[model samples]
Target: MKTFLNKVLVAYFAMTAGLILLNEPGYAYLWAGQGGTDVYIVHSGKDKEEKSALKKALGGDFKVKFYNVDLLALADYSGKQKAIIKLEKARIVIFIKDAPHELLEGSTLNTKVIIFNSGKDALKSKVKTFYLVDKTIAPPGGNTVRASSGSELNKAEAIRNADAVVVDGALDIYKAAALVVAALL
Candidate 1:
């Protein structure tokens, strides 16, 4: 028992040290040009379908966590503090609709945005980067809707012309998640 405990401690130390080094601020992300800042994705994970969808879109390692973001609190924040807090605590803030875009911007904050239509026009905001989900790309010989992963945006110059890009058999869940991330930008 003593020997086993000692081995566990050694393994824990090594893992912790390796992570600290790999996640250093200056290091770039393993994929994309994202910097090495810690990332925690917030999503509803509505069901097995969405969970599976996200995994297919981003990857198995991208974690999904549940969080409660109260944008109304911004009504009382009276300054740039609230938006900064939201940005700092989560990698991406996910809300279905009715999110108060006005409250999110502050005079002091340099604001940028990525908006998605998703057939919901009220979601459109005046932000800089917007992703209008105008088309639904289904799998071959299928009528279902799915979100394609960012892999398409990486190489598909004609993405704007095509309706949507479907993976193996359906829309990638993470592809929707990526869309959310894109809109939040």
Candidate 2:
């Protein structure tokens, strides 16, 4: 019995150590990138196009990272906490469509947050909030600007409340990327 217990303990310790090593921030940095991420994107993992567009739009100027988290997974407290930790580390956090508003719960004041197709329940935070709207949807009753193309987005000033900045859905991904890049600037 003593020998069996010792073997079980050794296996448990090995598993724990492996898990710790896999989750270490240094390990992630080494694999993902060498420096801190400038933009951290959390999305539903359904749209590959959106991810590619954002990356292209950001270009080589910024170090961006993407997290493909399932909305249902975030329902768990531990899962939500882990997502929040990553969110807080970013200079800017962009929540693509279907990403839960709950992930914004614990973000720091310095972090800038942008949400595309944000739901009405989006919690107000100390961090700067920018909401991207689809041109087809009605404006959510605040400062809004109509930007159909990248050039239009570049010309338009920040919406007074930044509550809504409309982007044409009919446009190509590059146009959408331009709008997002404009928001990030």
Candidate 3:
């Protein structure tokens, strides 16, 4: 009985230690690429069309990749640790759905955090949330463009031309990506 109890205690401690280790940072190698800017998008994999649009929006300047961070095995974790591990290599981290609040936990992470909002309640936190809208399906009056809308490529120049007028709630992936690039630039 004594030996069994000792083994159980050891196992418990080991598991605890492992969990602690999982929370530490430095996991950039996961986003391996040939050498362009790396952008990581943490999505739920349900929005196939939106995902494709986002990729199309990315110019040659970025190596865009999508990751479904909410796996059953890692369900217990807030996913902030996973974000931290790959934070170093990622130029920007975009949250399509299920934004990991853990990323904003403790000290601020060096990578940028973008939360894509599609009529969902915004996070109470002050972090940037890009409003998104589906232009083809929505009722009239609201501004939303189709995913393949051939808007001008010069979002930054347009933004500048607007005299600093900030546009909110992007219509499609192209516009969203343009907004992100503008912010980064």
Candidate 4:
């Protein structure tokens, strides 16, 4: 009985230690990326069209990572922290619509932020903002643009406003990617 009890205790301790080690910052990087992520897409994961569009836009050349904000919210405190670290490390972070309020509130990101249909609330935390607006409406200001087509995205006036570019949600995914890529440039 004594030997059996000792073996059980050892197994318990081993599991606990493993859990702690997995939470360490070093381990967190394994999920973030080995070569490093160029772009981090934060979305709800329900919209396949948006995902396909962003992928098509970025092509296969860049290292892109996607994080479902909804899932991140459900994770434990350490898990959320790990995600924040990954987000901060990325060169560019894109916040798709339906992003959880809690995640955005907790993050202190100092990178180029692109807000896609997420709403104006996200713009409050960002330093340099790129807003994506639909092509049907006139751009609210220099910082906004109608992402209807490649031509519209390449316009001098459109590119001149580097502070932020609001893309139209109704526009095609390919066109949206063009606007996003344009914003990246």
Candidate 5:
């Protein structure tokens, strides 16, 4: 009985320690790309808690346009393709995962991306909620990005300057830590 109790304590400590490890800078946010460059992926549903949590995850200001993708109602790839194309250009893309992977993967989006999945589609197209960011930031110019349909310009600027962003929920703490590391690198 003592041995079993010891094992339980060790497991509890291990889990607690693991949670603290993943909350670093780049490791915390939604996607794997730079704040201003890559597309942003956040899983905030309407007025969900994750929305505020996602904002908290970013190191700086984070204003983004939110959209809900009714995966159940969505049909066909063309609409998905168009949406993906649209997201790739914006500084951040916050939407549900109703669109097809082919459409998303094929879009000309090297920008930051934020995706929200209902613990579903977590493993897809070799990219899970991890926001498999295989893109890079283009040369930084004083070039002002087209203002996203969010809040004020000043507020948006601050979010753009953010260092890290969170994609998943607190349960995916490990991924968040990884995001911090990736962003700093």
Candidate 6:
């Protein structure tokens, strides 16, 4: 009975340790680049699929470093402050969803901003260049692998021709980000 109890206890501890390791890692990520420029991506939180898509688009380009941070905690004062500090270091800043208004209150003359599915409030940001994702490259009805845009303004050629590139419903964030990044390259 004693030996059986000991074995059971050991198993319990092992299971607990395994569970801890299985937990997902933090959202903060820094992908090193060889180039002098840095690209900062601020989003709500981690999305495995989106990250994978972005990585596929990177194609070993060591020139641009990718820094991703989650603003899910932005309601807290500390979280907001931390995000501002991080944003200040970026040469290119991409804001997905509703980024805090405070982010645009400072000097953005040298920074390039890419906005996706954001509201008119984002227009207030003063950046060197602004790129918006009007729609995704994916086709409608969720039945095809091909990419298409609902509006003429959102097409790949349009994105390339406009002031900058821009997304909307049915478009995966990862795919959209990949498209914009690819266009920039």
Number of backbone-clashing residue pairs for each candidate, in the order shown: 6, 0, 1, 9, 32, 8
What is the model-wide C-alpha lDDT for candidate 1? 0.40
- The reply for model 4, stretches above 4 Å from the true place, is 1-33, 123-127, 135-142, 155-160, 166-173, 182-185
Better by TM-score, candidate 5 or 3 = 3
Spell out the clash pairs found in candidate 1.
Answer: 53-173, 53-174, 54-173, 54-174, 114-183, 146-171
Report how far off residue 32 is in candidate 1 (Å).
19
User: Candidate 3: misplaced stretches above 4 Å?
Assistant: 1-37, 72-79, 98-108, 119-173, 182-185
User: lDDT of each prediction vs. the true structure?
Assistant: 0.40, 0.64, 0.50, 0.62, 0.40, 0.48
Task: Give me the overall lDDT of model 5.
Answer: 0.40
Model 4: per-residue Cα lDDT over 15-67, one tens digit each: 89996998699898655545777888777767556866787788776788888
Lowest lDDT 10-mer window, candidate 2? 152-161
Q: Ten residues in a row with the worst lDDT in model 6?
A: 137-146
- What is the TM-score of each predicted model, taking all chains together? 0.35, 0.63, 0.48, 0.63, 0.33, 0.45
Worst 10 residues of 5 by lDDT: 126-135
lDDT of 1 by residue, 133-158 (tens): 42442222212223444454453334
The best candidate in terms of lDDT: 2
Off by over 4 Å in 5: 1-39, 42-47, 71-78, 91-109, 112-185
Candidate 6 lDDT by residue in tens digits, 75-108: 4656544555566466666655454333443334
Candidate 2 RMSD to the correct structure: 6.0
